[model samples]
Target: MTKLMIVEDDEKIRDELRLFFERYGYVVACATQFDHVVDEVLSAKPDILLLDINLPYYDGFYICRSIRKQSKMGIIIVTSRNAEMDELMSMNLGADDFVTKPFNTQILLARVASLAGRVRQDGVQTSVLNYGNFSLDANKMLLICGERSCELSKNEYRIAACLLRERGKIVTREQLMDDLWNNHQFLDDNTLTVNVNRLRRKMSEIHAEPSIQTKRGVGYRL
Candidate 1:
């Protein structure tokens, strides 16, 4: 069964959603304390997250960004904010999907199921890899942080994925260049630097600094 985490603060809505999802064969865990949301999320390690924009203490975006630091799980923002900017911002923050308030329960269920399926399919190779506020999907080349996600280009994905897989461990620059380029022996060093910068920018977009710390004389580490 797919496990889901519900991060809504409204007691009535949370209960309804929990009951509704449970009926759909999902194992649902609803947040009881806003302050401990992160701890709860890490412990639950849910397959998908149902987030409300208006959360207690810290807003949903902060929580999403925080989780994005180390999880590639599906994230769906179900909120009352209906503005286009709100939707855009949610996506930018790392949400896989956005459903406004007063949504159809069936539709919400369907979206959750769809996302859950994708996450499961991709889970085969992407068992785990963590960055600051982002996680890399080794199989899908997907960069996820909170409600925002960015699809990585082949080289970009490989480089970032490599760093994340060996997070906290150094990966030499030469090794990274070779891994990313494969048989391409003529790839420029400057080109590698450029790709790294672009990947760094993408990571920073969702509030995660590049966990890719340079060793100056060595390589990079997440």
Candidate 2:
């Protein structure tokens, strides 16, 4: 099922859209905090975004450009601003489409469906996990910190991917082992330790600060 995120600040419109999309079998997430729109959207990892131009802190144009820098997710500018310049600006900032306020619900749904299809067709890999100043490209097995990037070994990539996906949260040693060895068999603890140390060293080579922290008896957190 496609996941959709609504970034409108109006509570009424946000709720209505959430319910409408939920009824249609789309997994929906609404932005509760306007200040960190990009972080919220990235954390949700939605397939499409229904964004409003008038927002607190930063406008939708700024948010769209910021997201575009790291992701190619579908963005539809749903705003009250009907100016031609607004639409053109949205397109220039990588928005897939623009729909003015008081839009036809059916037409909006159709646009989202169409854009989602195109995004999938393009095979745009937007599964990057951003933690602090680092972005982990799981698909390419690359750990990117600013302009520097280091390729990861298969085991190192899997471990880093897991930790970054659950950034700031504890990923249990048992869970890490399970992810490393998919057959349900336990691997030596020292092997997992070695792989993690190697990933840390690679991260240091690129000057990625605040290295992965170990939770000792628990697990690890990035």
C-alpha lDDT score of every prediction, in listed order: 0.76, 0.82
Model 1, 36-143: lDDT tens digits are: 887788788888899998987888888888877778888999999999998898888888999999999877876775575456323442243443455566567778
- lDDT string for model 2 (1-222, tens) is 567899999999999999987765577899989888899988887888999999999999999999888777899999999999999999999999999989998778767755654463135644454555566675787988778999998888888877755655689988999987884434579888898899999999998755889887988887
What would the TM-score be for candidate 2 when compared with the true structure? Answer: 0.55
lDDT of candidate 1 at residue 209, scale 0 to 100: 50
Runs with alpha carbons beyond 4 Å of true place in candidate 1: 120-222
Write down the worst ten-residue block by lDDT for model 1: 120-129
Give the lDDT of residue 6 in candidate 1: 94
Q: What TM-score does candidate 1 get on C-alpha atoms?
A: 0.55
**RMSD of every prediction:** 15.5, 14.5
Q: Considering only N, C-alpha and C atoms within 3 Å, which residue pairs clash in candidate 2?
A: none
- Clash pairs, candidate 1, are 68-133, 68-146, 69-133, 69-134, 93-147, 93-148, 94-147, 94-148, 95-147, 95-148
Best candidate, lDDT: 2
* Root-mean-square deviation of Cα positions for candidate 2 versus the true structure, in angstroms: 14.5
